[model samples]
Target: MGMIGKYARLTPGELQQILGDPALGHRLVEAMGEDEEDGRRLDVDKAWHAMSFFLDRLGFPVEVVFGEQEVAGAPDWGYGPPRYLPPAQVRVAAEGLARIDGATLTGAASRQELFEAGIYPDSIWTRDEDALAYVWAHYDSLVAFMTTAALAGDAVVTWIS
Candidate 1:
């Protein structure tokens, strides 16, 4: 599988527990797999890097796309251990994401820009409109995911798989 990005909303207590025992992070990843349609989880597919570039171009901190805290000892599903954003940071990220209108998201980065930035999974970015559409759709999903996590006062755990 390619480097798909996954996000799961976690309760504050859940975050604390995971921090104390990083292996618990695996359970969250498994739970995400069990029910992808579950509101608590989001799979951004292969559009992660392009989404990151666009969001960064829109002025949101890169951490909002990746994460802040690394969960030491968490299983490396693919890229690395899961990283997370606390509830406070989630709220801030949600605010920034919410401010991004569709037009801005679509126009922030051109295909050439994405290619030049050396975004991951390079082959996909060569497809012109399809590539942009893929990234836009996933970015929209991400905005909704962060917004919901913030409203629920939950932290967000992100991992690449």
Candidate 2:
């Protein structure tokens, strides 16, 4: 299955709605390319790229919070080479969500730790049943995919599914 298919099923319209920024949408469209012959489901590579782009432009400070052990000169997230986006960007996105929602982090964990936890560095705890349920149902899948991709040398941006 494609990446987005693994988590909460989102129609193209739903994706467009969630990705409310027009510029980001346009960027995603460009990343997806103009292949009219294929239906509009985002290609895996394009979807990954678009996700990264969306995170970078989403009006949050993605400052490079240092990882536990700064592997000297190791490419962030260890995405070996020929990557479309920065792996740090993905961590920033993930942690950014937690930060936004007042979720307390046990200090900054490496991308690996966040991956293993299957949650953002900042945890999610909410009283709103619907919102909490939605997060519980889908966040892990999203985090897992991103973590796996990063570990396997693919550029992936962290985001809520």
Scored by TM-score, the top model is: 1
- Per-model TM-score versus the true fold: 0.90, 0.27
Cα distance off (Å), candidate 2, residue 27: 13
Tens-place lDDT digits, model 2, residues 1-161:
32222112223453344345433433443454545233332123212322232333455454212111222322322232111224455445455544432112222323344334343322322222243334333333344543443444433322212
Over 1-161, each residue of candidate 1 has an lDDT whose tens digit, in order, gives 87888888999999999999999778755766747577888888888887777777766764866799888778886788889999999999999888886568768567777778799878776775688877778888988999999999999999888
List clash counts for every candidate, in order: 0, 0
**Cα error of candidate 1 at position 96, Å:** 0.8
Task: Output the lDDT of residue 132, model 2.
Answer: 32
